[model samples]
Target: MQAIIFVRLFRLLLGRQGPLLLSLLLWTALGI
Candidate 1:
């Protein structure tokens, strides 16, 4: 489903930026 595709995309991003991107995402979530 869509969730599976999202997870795959997230894993691909994590493989690239990893910590920086993760922190940015967390901060954005907290900000929201």
Candidate 2:
């Protein structure tokens, strides 16, 4: 399913970008 693919992509991004990705997510959530 699409959700599974998204989870896999998220994992890949976390593996590659780690903290940078997490910070970006927080900023996006805060609308900054």
Colliding residue pairs in candidate 1: none
Runs of candidate 2 with Cα error greater than 4 angstroms are 1-8
Give the worst 10-residue stretch by lDDT in candidate 1: 16-25
- Which tens-of-lDDT digit does each residue in 10-29 have in candidate 2? 77879866788778877987
Q: Give the TM-scores of the predictions, in the order they appear.
A: 0.55, 0.55
Per-residue lDDT of model 1, residues 1-32, tens digit only: 99789768888979967888778878986996
Off by over 4 Å in 1: 1-5
Clashing pairs in 2: none
Candidate 2 lDDT (Cα, whole model)? 0.80
For candidate 2, the 10 contiguous residues with the lowest summed lDDT are: 16-25
Provide backbone clash counts, one per model: 0, 0
Q: Each prediction's Cα lDDT score?
A: 0.82, 0.80
